[model samples]
Target: MSKDTSRVRLTAGRVEAFTCPAGKAQAFLWDTEAPSLLLRATPTGRKTYAFESRLNGATVRISIGTASDWSLDTARKRAAELKQLIDRGEDPRELEKAKASHKAAAKAAATAHALTVGDLWPDYLETGKPKRRDAWKPRYLEDLKRMSAPGGEPKKRGKGTTRPGPIYPLLALALVDISEDALKEWHDNEARASKHQAARALMMFRGFLRWCATKPKYRGLVDNEAGRAPAILENLPSMKRRTDALEAAQVAGWWAGVEQLNNRTASVYLRALLLTGARREEMAGLKWADVDFQWRKLTIADKVEATRTIPLTPYMAQLLATLPRVNEWVFASTKTLSMAVYNAKRRERDATQAGRTAPAGEVSTVSESGRMSDPRSQHAKALLSAGIEGLTIHGLRRSFSLLGEAAGAPAGAIAQVMGHKPSATAEGYRPRSVDALRPFLTQIEAHVLALAGVQFDAQVEPGKLRVISAQ
Candidate 1:
């Protein structure tokens, strides 16, 4: 019989010797051992191992590899495996695709397994935000950064390196390893030093886990509720609602002590907190643009809303006019310590200079934020001088609520001026326009001033300073 040259057994030598005809675009040589297997060559001498077969009345050609990468015998064995899939009435192309998909899934799983919380924390901070907010507020964002900070740098106020943040330890943990048991252990360890700080950190971390769960790539890797596991919640410190406001009688002393403060700006800030019942930060963030002396109104940054306008009482307008327009801030920061405080610190440094010489440069009391930052230390000094114990900065806010009621102002009006969320039980709970809120605010201010024994003259020209006298 004549040699059947169309079907020849493939060999490394025969495959190498094969070439496409000069005028033809391509040529093929079929292996007798695996009839579906073929070595294909192009006119430019490119060659490859491929499996070609009929499946469901259509021809399917699958490229296995290049001629150099696969030996003749290995190519034949792979082709035989593909043919088996076709014989079983399955598409070899589909089988090859399934294998590729499984390989890709395994690779992705490996990559996910290697991911740590530290790797994704920055991304979370950048995109994650509280409900109804466009982005994290600057204060809250700083809190988040502090919670996860790796602290080895020198303290801002003292001698030693700062401690690592409460959440820093968890950053090294792999996302897949975050479990109820893991979080419970971390919470227990952190709660040892400061229960409230640890609890706050846990709350913030839960926000992180919630954000991660929303991502497709990180979905299955973390359990969003792990931070809130019952084991962890049970150990949280009992939350105590602070009731530390100035008593009606204590207001006279607080006012006197505040007026005696050496830092005039701090004295004004502390008094402003009491008079307006604004949160410390909200008051500190005040700008000159937000004050409207001509309209006898002040626009305050509200905690519950974008902004709230309240009538600027006579005393407050006069009080504001006394403040120098140092910068944009209604209460601008001086960024320097009072002469007495600075002298005391200098004396202490001189006393300790024998061991190690202090750095010889100006000591900045606080970073210049263009607005007043923490007045707590000065507030504490004021409290101590007044012989009033347990009164907090927020206590001033509570005091305003208590005193406003004592002054017979409606609950809704008090709530509105204080930037509190209105409730159904508050009288006239509906939102009142700034003008309608005027009489109530002025009434509250008058009552507070009377209690503090402050006498003020409101007869000055608009935008001019009105004199206030303390009895």
Candidate 2:
């Protein structure tokens, strides 16, 4: 028995090989039944194991594990295993794949037990929230709270009972534990209650789960469970047709109703919404600095990035002039008298955070001590008082757009003034001057006032009209 000394060892400066017995070298090289192992050296002097065998009249070479872990005995055993598979007409590659898959499955199952939907939700929000233009973060958190099931009801009568929303039942389940059956059940139940809500909740959940798969801790858990949930059937109820915009005639009636509103701040806020074609929040959140009275321009900080400047019509300017300068807010709350109130108390904190400040005057209304009320709440009250039905502060903005278009404002001009993306045609031309939009905004305000039959000045008062309650 002689060692061929033709093979290289992975360790530096070591070489070993095997020489077949006489008449066996060629037989060993070409025979499918016999397994042979060799060692090779690279130009860099690194060594590696090379196992060779003949299968179906073709020679194949495979590297057993690296020399650091593959001792001679282990290498020989691996080679023997390959030889056995070849003899049995089975590929050694298939066996390796099967073993790998089994190991992966076992590891995934072990990790899945520790991974929950709650653990992966924040990562999903961080990734997906940037893609939407709306304020979806607060909405998403609200949905999460709704989806979180309550332990029990409250004890007091006036206190609201704590109950989990429809999606809450599944939040406690691990990502891998959420089977198709469970998801289908949740979907069916949510759809049965309110298909629109169910659809939205499912979409958020699916997005969260997809994001989970990208993270290291919850990767395999999401891959197997969340990815496998069945798609919800589209047999849910039809959605209500949203009155997103008002028609020419309806705009008149609605405006007429708005004019009858008695609340001074809400009236001004609603008028601003119509005059600027700004979203409810943007107008409600307006600070005095955002308004350039000298220029007659209102700068609206949009929900999306970028600020838009809308030319204030004479009517809107006059409306602004009517309000006392009790606070930094253009629409200061009468309740606080010092601070501006918007949407009543609910949004007071948000208003303050948005830089609400006391005006350079003593507080007169509501004991001169309390913070201002939210203008949005006051706007809602005014709308209700004016006998306006099914119209929100946002509707006032939509009405402005529709009326602006009706008044012959160009679509691009309307979109630009409304803080929408400029059309391709408009982008090619130089940005339109603020003066160019002045006539259109002026027309829109006049149209709204005419519809509401409002008399901004004593000279404009027509015959008296009876007001009716919306309720």
Best by lDDT: 1
The most accurate candidate by TM-score is 1
Instruction: Tell me how many clashing residue pairs each candidate has.
Output: 0, 18
The digit string of per-residue lDDT tens for model 2 on 151-242 reads: 46674334767555666766677787776667777888877777787776676576666666566766655544542444644444455555
Candidate 2's C-alpha runs over 4 A off are 1-101, 109-116, 129-171, 176-181, 184-199, 206-237, 244-253, 333-335, 338-388, 423-433, 453-471
Collision count of model 1: 0
In the predicted model 1, the residue pairs found to clash are none
Which stretches in model 1 have alpha-carbon errors above 4 Å?
Answer: 1-5, 9-13, 53-60, 83-91, 152-163, 247-250, 253-267, 284-311, 317-389, 410-413, 420-438, 460-471
Give TM per candidate: 0.75, 0.57
Model 2 / residue 294 / CA error / Å: 1.8
lDDT of each: 0.83, 0.61
Question: Could you give candidate 1's per-residue lDDT for residues 34-136 as a string of tens digits?
Answer: 8998888888898898998988888888998989899988998899988888999999777768999999999999989999999999998898987777988
Predicted structure 2: lDDT? 0.61
